[model samples]
Target: MAQWYQTWNKPLKNILWWLVIIGMVVSLPLAYTRHQTETSANQVEFVFDYRDLLDISDIQTNPRTFVAEQLKNMKAAGISSMAVYESTLAELKESRRIEVYNSRDAAALTQTLGDPNENFTYVLFADSATQQKLEPLIQKTFADLKVGTKPWSFKNRNGLIIQMSMDDASIKGMDPDPMTLQMLKDQGFQIVVRLSNRRPFVTNEMDRLLKQLHDIGVKRIIVDGNEVPGYTEENTEINLNKMADLLNKNGIGLAAIELLKEPQKGFSTLSKQTNYNVVRLHSFTEKDGEKLTEPLKKSELQDRIQGVADRLVLAVKDRNIRMVFLNARPVKSLDKGKLVDPLAAYYESLQGKDGAIPRIQEVGFKLGPAEPFDVKTTGWQKIARIFILLGGVSLIVLMVSFFVPEATLLLFVLGILGLAALHTLSANLYAQGLALSTAISAPSIAIMLAIRSVRSGAAAKWKSGLAYALWTLIKTSAISLIGVVYEVALLNHVTYLLVLQQFRGVGVLHLLPIAIAGVYLLFFSENNTYRDKIANIRSILSSFISVLWIVVAGVALAAVYYYLSRTGNEGQASTLEKLFRSFLENTLGVRPRTKEFLFAHPLFLLGAYLSVRYRHAVYLIFIGVIGQLSIVDTFAHLHTPLHISLIRISYGLVFGALIGLVLIAAWEIIIRSWKRWVPQLSK
Candidate 1:
């Protein structure tokens, strides 16, 4: 009976094992194909809406025509910097700067002759904020100019090449009264007081400005939006209501509230009591000014504009408002001679549908197509995948269960030891699973060889050979199980979060299941009793120490990476440190406030202590998992919302109770099985 069993079991088991091996080989390529198919890109379509077009007739008129013409010549010359001399003929003869233009002739003849000097600056007839937005662009374009100072900062656009300022002679209405001049100055009109007309509460200068604005092609504007600079009558309720109704009646589309700067003074009756929904306006300043004539330059602008456009379009699509106002530096000529179609231009800039700008534009706008929605893996698909992977692993395990069961037990233990070691070395739990798989494959073959050796009586130490083979299997299983547990818990949390938050980090937890399966193998190695294995605690300690050394090596490597990144390496040391710090802070709830020294922190000591202590490993694992699981509250670069110490205490208590319950249940099962078997054996 023994002979027949041995002879048939050996060949039959080998054949069954080969079938499982074939299945695994088939799975790899198929799995790769499935993964690729799932992640492949495909075309999708969606509608998009663009923002309102700019109104620029004021910059295109007679005196202002020179500003537009100079800008046009500058664009044509590709020389943004220019110098304006007193005489046009003198400037044209010896000067290379863009020739100055007189206030009238429709052509407003300004032509660039040659290269302008680095210090050459443009004359802007606009306010300080409008001038501020030109520095970055000017500096980059005429890079040699080092035109880094904003227009508003300098006494004049250093050379007054292309000027944008109100014509000085246009200020005519003055009663010549000291009190009135003082009152205008006190009312905050050093440059020009654009006031409300025919109103009991305010002056009439704004009505005159609006008339001038209309003459210069400003068909629609809201004078009420312009906040009077120095009108600090404590109760502005009546003023705001009258202003709002006046604006609504006048059909003004834009308003500029000036110097109501204190946002936290709390909403006054102007905002609270009125129906005029004030959309906060933001626009380009001298500090933010950069041209976008190039393709990539425009792409950047498109992205930013489209992002805000998409948000607002979605938000305000149902409203009757046809145009929204933004403060922007005036645009005269977009490209040398090409006229940008205002209606078509704004629509194309929306970055929607076929009109979307190409991805290469380099502009401030940071817009792009919305990311593809990720489909949640259904339960059946997940179950199928999990079963297939586990089945392949279990087949190998089953083979070990047949012969040299004790060796299988040892291998399982060793595999777990290797897994924990690998995890410490590489924070990835899935890498530990792969390492366990590779480590166990060799042991499986070795056990088979050892069994053959014992069967043929080539070596007399059959019991010892069986013990070694079983030991190998047990170590492998332990590693596999530990890895599995790590994987399951992590993946469960991660997948749940992905479902909840729809973030990419959700897939990060998927690695945990692989680690758990690897760990499970460690716990259930074939035919080895816990009593027999407990005697090898010294060996377990040695393995633990060995893994600890590898962890130390990893720490040394991380330290070296940190040091080189900071000191001499031409790399982003600060960025790398921030990334590492972010990961650690999330995992340990031990965020170092400053980026001064990461490796030398007390947390490193804690990690070292946990590495050396087995009990601490359990605590660190739970703390690490929960710490990673906790929501991060980030304000700028600061991350909050994790309390590592609390997490450790809570997880330790909960997991300890769980482990105790499992042990008790396991003990009870063992006793029941023993009672049933022992009585039968005695009978």
Candidate 2:
């Protein structure tokens, strides 16, 4: 033993350990309390939408002034684009007719007036005799025929979408506007011409409409796919592609298709065109299973907006796309001809509760650098500060242990308290989610714990195979679980939507933990002997290989999940999947744990439990660490909630531990049975 080891006093060490514990218990909650307010992460949601020119234009008023005001409001509200119709069918001359119908034709029209939802105004040219023959029907249908030279209109659940026909196929653009669109353009406006088809989905007249918008300086087109009802699987893609091509020729560069299905092949091909644009629109058309309309309660309106915002962050995180369009008329339900308002409710939805914006810049998206921010996060900087703080604490632990060997208990207590304090400080400081901070710190903690465990025993007893696996798993899981609390701090302050946007991965955070672990292992020679140093290196390298195996195993598991979901028998997964499903169905009740929870957490927990004592328990526990990776992978997708992730990992720890105990019990039983059978065979 070293001379310094002999001088270490037991009583002093115990007192120091208790002091560290006392300090931690008090400071940790204080940090949590300081950061307990609502989320303040800054990120701008780039949202745009289409508004009816009728929203601001009224034939009854000075339409130009109203439209210009709406446009200016749009610019101020951070709206990236705006859309208006070339013209509705009701606006066309062909839809209106001056008819002095004979009494017989009027009688026939009167018979057909029962339902107004069906298309009406069919043109008929018949002799006087034929009209007389058809005049015996009810007078109800004739009521429509008596009204001469007026436009026909319809009302549906959406209030009104006026239909019109092309009066002259040659007239491309809309009727004259109040202000030159060139002004909006000069101010950096992106105007899209919405082609409202009275005819179904085919773009027979679209070629003409595109020319008019192009002539009017409109650069984008929003196509309503429902307008094209005649297309099939074979022709829809081709027809859409052709429409896109037509738009390109007219110098209309962007096409936004509001299709309900996955985009067809032709759209994919057209999207690649240099001048052609296809914004894959995911519209929040429904609220509580009904289409969005006015007259909804204020609470319902707020809920719907929040729900859409949450989905937006989740939907676009890794999609590799630049823009998203929200199809909404979130302004209060205005009366007909009452469209002179900017969508204030819609803009309110863009912000989370208390106007908490996430860190859009951290997610590698910056709409405008000069845009003012009410909130911001330290991002990777806070993580670096955390790791540095942790490293200092670790060094203090090492130095104290080196001089006073009897102070081992105190050092251990100090380490835990320091880690807890660090966790509290980081949770308070970064204001992003906690998983990233935890994930970055985990591997280092595992390395340090593994070193401590190995130093306490004979090196050879734990050097190879199952022993190494057990050690790695236990150490890894303990640290991973430690990281879980970091996110628990954030649960009440933000929604899953804001959390996903702000808490996206940092490259430094991903690599720092592994780097810290690697560097620490290099100098952490077991027993301070050259032989032990080589062994420690070898062991750590083996641990790295195991970590690689865990990673590969995670990927392989994902591939298997995908394949099973897509190609399994009748699309049914294997029994193991079913078992997880059953477990979740029973335990999670209606809340529903995801496949990540079912597959990953329990397995990691199992690894953690098995890692307790058995020499080969690490093999089982390795799966648990893989579970942690699965959880980490879930974050990359930006879909899982912070609380949900916590629940999943916590359940995994408990359930996995139970499973491990069950397996160990069964194994012991099998061993006893084998012994008895062998003795009988020998006899």
Candidate 3:
């Protein structure tokens, strides 16, 4: 026992023993917990759509200049107690506030002899009385005084609001100075001309005003200050319907109409009555400016934005409206002459269902905290523990294989199978959406076992296999580590796109480590001249047979498989079995139809090719039994007849023969070169 331990122990350098033991011990808890968590992990996905409800598509018109000029006209009216405030560039930059210049600044600046130092326009806010006062001033300065006001106040001031109504005589007597009006008009000024006097077109007054407005070529009008008479709750519907029909028939495609009271009570009724497609209107107004126009706090803004978004969604869903036309007071109002705007919030909230709105979907389970001890209710720990335990057992078996040199062949077979089995398990776990912890750990036992066995045996014969396994383990570990790190940190939508890019990079680099290991193994081993000659001869003959008969058989079987897979044949499974059995019988001389003569003939290169033929026979049989089906084909695109033919012919004939040639050349060189470094191990 001591001697076996000594032999095995010496090969695994002291540093490696400590590393293996410590690394495994530390990884146990993490691996166990990771697997448990992975099993419980679930992804929640939701999809929302609000295209028909919030008809952003309908509002696509050029309103930029119109809004700017309207704000300008409001300022020019000299509406007392109304002020025009300028938003600084810095403020605009910080808040994305769209600043509109008032006509007062436009008129004053134009009349100045030189350009003013300031380069800003004003936003105006006033009560109804003040607005009416400003209307005459605008009429005096501008050719068209299109004055408008709601029955209720819609400005950011904290005082009593009084509304004044003038008689026809007073309106007729108010003559605007032509030159002043022209100057005001040149400075982008206009009138907020009111149409109704506390009621809609009574006593032929509406017809007369409409005629005057048409004669003057007035394009925009604000039909405000109209209060519909006597709402008997029961007949309100009839009256509202009458109003909508009348407005629609009149061809009034103006910007706004101030509705004095709630035309309809229910959300559905409001949606149906409000003709957003025709014009926007403000129904409710503030009597106390301080109460209505107050700036929202940060929290208030967030809540209001969310509430508005929710209401908008509900309105769209219930009303069957294509677009929404909001009252302009939200943006028009000001506090202490300063406009309190929530432009960012408003814009962000308006994003339709698919754009930014959260979708409602099913969520199965709540996620628990991810900690070593506190990992709540994920299956990662159980599964990870199993893999870690398997790895530990594999390691112990690997150590045993080191001393039991005769068991080396069995260990090698197990190692190869283990690698394949673990990788397949990893892929399955990944497909199931299990977290990284559920994946079987890549076995380093392969390298450890190979090092222990080869360090004590005839090195030349099996050292290549050991080197191959060693490099594969290292490559896989590096790849997995990098992939895990990337997944952990990736979150944003932009970075998610890079996932495919990273995979491409990894795939391109995959072959390099194997080539490097092959080179290292070739150079590091002691070489025998006689063995090199024999091995080379064997390699050449094997390559020829592999390229010819073996390749032909592979191509034929592959063609059958491809056809069967595409046709979705039920008989293909049994046919595959027969084909594989036949192939095995032909290559290994194992079935009733075996050719004894071929196995016995000395000229047939029996001893040199027997192992290759036997192994390939088994491999071919296995391939046939586990024939690639259409479902599998869809994923890997592996059943292409052309690709299969090319792989067999090119890899088997050209590359295989070339590989044999390279091995021969390398063996000969190694025989000469390695003699100086290492003595050949003798059985």
Error of 3 at 513 (Å): 8.0
Off by over 4 Å in 2: 1-70, 91-188, 195-212, 215-217, 226-251, 254-259, 262-265, 272-277, 286-308, 315-318, 329-342, 351-612, 615-683
Model 3 TM-score (2 dp): 0.24
Cα misplacement distance, residue 540 of candidate 3 (Å) = 8.1
> Poorest 10 consecutive residues of model 2 by lDDT?
156-165
Write down the lDDT of every candidate, Cα atoms only: 0.32, 0.42, 0.31
Candidate 3 wrongly placed segments (more than 4 Å): 1-32, 35-98, 101-509, 512-613, 617-683
Q: 383-413, model 2: which lDDT tens digit per residue?
A: 4444433433433343344334566655656
TM-score of each: 0.24, 0.38, 0.24
Poorest 10 consecutive residues of model 3 by lDDT? 45-54
What RMSD does model 2 have?
18.9
lDDT of 1 by residue, 78-107 (tens): 221111111211211121222222233212
Best by TM-score: 2
Off by over 4 Å in 1: 1-55, 58-231, 234-267, 275-345, 354-683
